[model samples]
Target chain A: MTGRHDPYVRLLRWYPKAWRDANGAVWVDTLREQSEAEGWSRPSRGEAVAAVVNGLGTRLDARAAAQLALGGIAVRAAVEVTMQIASPGGISVQDPALNGLVWIFLSAFAIPVFGGLVALSRSYGVLSPRRALAVLAAGAVGICLFAAAMWASAYGFQLADDNPALARVASAAIPLGAAALAIGATAGWLVVDGMLSRTRLRRLPRAALSLVAGVVLAGLAGYATMMTLGWVTVGVTVVGLSMRSLGGWSSVEPRVVVRSRLSLVRTLAGISAAISMLGIGYAVTAPAWSPLAENPTTAVVHAILVLLVGALPLVVALGLLAPRPRLHVWGPVALVLVAMAATFYGYTDAPLSTRIDSSVPIGSLALGLSLAWWVTARLATSRGDRLMAGIAITLACVVWHLAALLPVAVFVLPLVAGVLAVRGTLARREPIQAVRTAPVTDR
Target chain B: MATPLTPSAFWILTVLASGRRHGYDILSQTRTASDGRVSLKVATLYAALDRLETDGAIRADGDEIVDGRARRYYVLTDAGASRLEYEATAMAHAAKAAQRHLATRPALLTLAPVIR
Candidate 1:
């Protein structure tokens, strides 16, 4: 009889092609023999599902796991570098010669990370379009609130002599406002992260099951604990699996080889994370420190930025970098719903600094118009042209920063991209193999 | 590092250690060997078998057809035999250690007169 009558034979489609090629015929024969003797018409649902689940498990070979790790690392490093660019002289390193060239390269804008954000949201938008855009909108609001707080502090300090008590109250409130911003933002990300964790738990790969669990759990837990558990566990588990690569696998399993390669990847990610934390801590704290420690405004902003720097990877690793689930997609749904709930970002990044809000109304309008144009351009352009256009627009954006619209460039660019994505007018997802990842400006 | 085999793997290897067996035979015998407690689905059984063969612990000894069904007979490789022996030895040691610990239990429960 043709194997068509047997459901198990047909179910071989679930196993990967390579596996089916080698073991298909015998495997089918085994199933048939067993089923016939038992007088069963077909394998039960559980049996068929086990086959499929294990079949998918076989696909998570060493290389795919490595790619997963690369994606994780890319997200971590990108945010760090982005933050550093925004808050330069937080370290006050007098590279007088390099300074002009650094400014001239005019490419310190932290756009790619947001590009990654848009990519994640767009490509893996298992959530409905309206819902996802709404979440982006919420993130935008938190950013705007932060910008407003900064503006209030800077302008409040400028007119302090005229209104001393009001200025002190405003300056004192900056840190609290920024903290509230981080907390609100983090809470929003946590809700999304929780859902992503649930999705990951359901479709976990056998090879990386425990490690994936570690990543998800670490994301929900505290940052210091998460760093140890998240980073170290990734390293330990990679080596641990190799050491015990089932049957203490001898030659063929190649866990030993994988262990070495993964360690190399782990080590690289470790160094990158360390540098980012240091730069962020030093640089972000610098802006808040201001040698004018008496400045309550500076003190509060410093505390929050430093905290965010140290704590950001946790937020990002889960919210931005965690793999999208192929099945249920409540993460997008929930994030955008949260976005809708917090939909108060009706303003742009105009109030982020004195340069725009206090001194240069025309510049502020120009900045707003320019960001709008960039978002519109992303929607209109073709793929390759979009990237080229992104680079050009990002350059122009950096020039705008150099031209005195500096402070808003930090998270505002990503915010605009988030807005673009939520509108569903953003460009289609690119093959952002940009495993390369950063720029935060801490000015 | 001589890791212990999983229960299904152990039973599968044990069945093959006795003699060469086909897929269904291995599946059925593993059930018997595991006292029907470790029943394996067909896919799970084959996945384990394939993994064992890949690990050089087992190999297809021969193949033939019976009643129009292919029978791929697999035998335990030297590696498989050694690993199985290692696992059995470790299990024996663990059992002995547990029994010893049980033997050393405090008589605090003696205060309770054998309450069921």
Candidate 2:
């Protein structure tokens, strides 16, 4: 009994803490009794794998759903922020280069959005909507205060400006930055709460907290010198990183068998994939809408860079949905940290020609198409139908000139999808009497 | 009526049909009942049990201490028993209907030879 219990006890670590506390010993005892009765001393490879996979999957589903919801909100805020950055102020012909700097700054928002999703997903298994909404409201207030601080800072700086040109650029950035941050903060915080869910939190290792504090402090100090800090995203980055280190963790059984949980995982994956595609589309069409690109060559290069930057965080984030290779689980957090550092350093200093014309909101079409696909696929009658619809919608977005309809698309697609997901789930589960009662056929 | 029970849920209830049984006892009895065709992993078992308990198909009967470890037992409720009975009847009816339909195929085969 002792020998058999030893192996099962090790395998029990593959389960979530709550689950283990409730049923761990009982399971271990069962394993022991089975093994002893079967004349075996250890669990089989299949048993171990099943346990690990299921345990990991339960955790991933919760994490991925939160990430997906946050990703959607972040993209929406980015659309708003980028629009502010691109808009021309008064009659003055703004420097496209300055616009690029701000875009880069706010673009770092993607890191928090991505990092929050992945980190929270890895550490937690469920999202409590009330908690999320509460957190979002609090974060929004914080962002508003932060925005006010920036506004005051910019106004004071304006008072002592030696160079009118530099002051003009600074002034433009201040409000645009504030608005973007305020918006992103409100939205991004919700994303965090949704992703973190109610997974139990272990005490933060002092070492880990100290490391994060040190990095954030260093980022702040560097910002004072280079003025490169994307203050908004840095705040988001800190919050995102903190959320990741904040949870209790769990383990395996086939990795993914719970349908209710898996549905969220599937929906999030589909949505993330769609968003990544939209990011790609946004890059490809840079030549059409951007004002700074004087030539085709620059536009093409900028487009590529845009896609790479946008997709990098998302790629890392979505990878965390599957619980394996440990690298995928933690790699996104590191990547996000790197992104935060880069944003703080203000790396978007390319010449005007290299920057995107984000003022036009050209990417909204892609966002709409993705949202359409996200919603439609979930409600589609079957998986095959969903797959075909996704392909069709994606192709249409790429080929058709539907960029103008984006505002409407963003609102409608998600709304329709939400309705369909709910309706479809309910409709599908109708009693057998409502279904065909004919004799079972071989086919 | 409620939707038909899933395979795991149905089996769990079937195991409980005999009497109240703890987690391990249910697992062991289920394996024996299925003649080794089914093996319920711990996570899967608990997920099913949890759902069953939620749906009012099963209830926690009691717990006992064995060798200093606690064993929580579960029993099929009236709802569960009736659900099982209905599912069994439905399956049996379907089987008879299919058997009758299949009986005609062999008869058709015999008629082919007679017609020749």
Candidate 3:
């Protein structure tokens, strides 16, 4: 009988029931052989116990694998939905013809953001700055190369029509923009690396370099933006002034992390760089009689708009997070309020135009202010002081949610808060008390 | 002439020098070799493996398939062997010198007995 207490039944318990049922004879034979080989007078309890444990473990592992396989389908579906939501505009342009031309271009811009986020999140305890830097550098290089390839494919092989003006402008602007990015990146690298080398100045230099780089880059960005405006009216005046203010604020902060500043700039740089790259890609891929050649203005404006909008939250976030000599959360708070008001105004007046006019600027301002307050509070105070920072960040995310797609807000806000919380927690736990009361052994 | 290896790396390399092994095998071997003085976590083992691979001190020999599952195997490279040798020599020399000094000091000898 296959009962529990019988010797054969008890021996059967040494294996998973399923396994025992299937290969019980083989295992029983092996155990019998092992017992004889050892010259044992009797089968040991320990051997039986070992066999039982091994069999149970195998059964559990198989069960777990089966469960995981079932679960994976749901997980993959969720991840795909999340990715689609995370994609800008909540749309997938999957037309094979369009995708063939566009996916490479879009991926080039998107990969850096993905890489940066991954690098930032993955670097919790053991990762060093050097390693983080390497990841970022690799991401940047990959984007640049992708952009170049796309540009070549779009333009290098094509013979331009009689219009030399278009070619001349491209020839001048593309090389100039590339040079500026290269020089700016090199300068940023030098400033950051130099500051990092010193022990005492390690933290301070990061913020300082980022701010300076942001200002210099902003000027180059402004010149590019100015070229596109057909009529420099009141709207242009407001945008121009706001741009200067944003650039000024970006460059002035001295106590923020360099990476934070770099991230802010890189987001903008990615858009601008992508715009330039997109032009090259379009030129390479499109036919000689393409409509994109009519006016590169819209393309340039779109790129600038995206870069400026995306960079705003990042800048504000860093500004908030840096250690301020005084209580200056109000500055960023005011900026957020203004942006919110603008978004409201834009929503009531004209919805389509609002996407560019109000939403972009407001989103930028909210992101910048929120990030600034969070970073500043984190660097300046203990865990106890984080409640205000957390509240401010939560508010900014809420504002961002209102202005932009919910998924963007969802992904960014929690990440910002999570990073701040982790930093605060670790700061509190610093100088971890010695576990042992005995004198530390000198090796 | 060689860079000094940390005690953790030296111990790990020594264990692998015997033969290719999996994570659990290396962990148990290290504990036995160090007489239960050294203990490593699965996380630490993987991290060390990453660094060792990057440094070209060790290579993944292959994987052993058992019951449709695979266990990764690692082996020490020639460079790893030389590094272990260098570290062992340095440690042995330092240990010998310290023992000699301790043995010769009469005051230390007297104190040692009292402490014991």
Best by DockQ: 1
Q: Which stretches of candidate 2 lie over 4 Å from their true place?
A: A1-5, A60-443, B108-116
1 against 3, candidate with superior DockQ? 1
Whole-model Cα lDDT of every candidate shown, in order: 0.47, 0.48, 0.45
Name the top TM-score candidate: 1
| Tens digits of lDDT, candidate 1, A20-61 | 887788888887777777788887777777776666545444
The native-contact fractions of the candidates, in order shown, are 0.60, 0.28, 0.00
**Model 3 C-alpha lDDT per residue in residues A21-91, reported as the tens digit of each score:** 64454344434444554576434665555554444333332222222222222232233334435654433
Q: Put down candidate 2 lDDT per residue, A24-44, tens digits, no spaces.
A: 777777766666666777777
Interface RMSD of 2: 8.9
Query: Which of 2 and 3 is the better model by TM-score?
Result: 2
lDDT of 3 at A78: 36
What are the RMSDs of all candidates, in order? 21.5, 26.1, 29.8
Please report how far candidate 1 places residue A150 from its true position, in Å.
20
Q: For model 1, what is the error of residue A281's alpha carbon versus the real structure, in angstroms, after optimal superposition?
A: 35
Give candidate 1's TM-score: 0.37
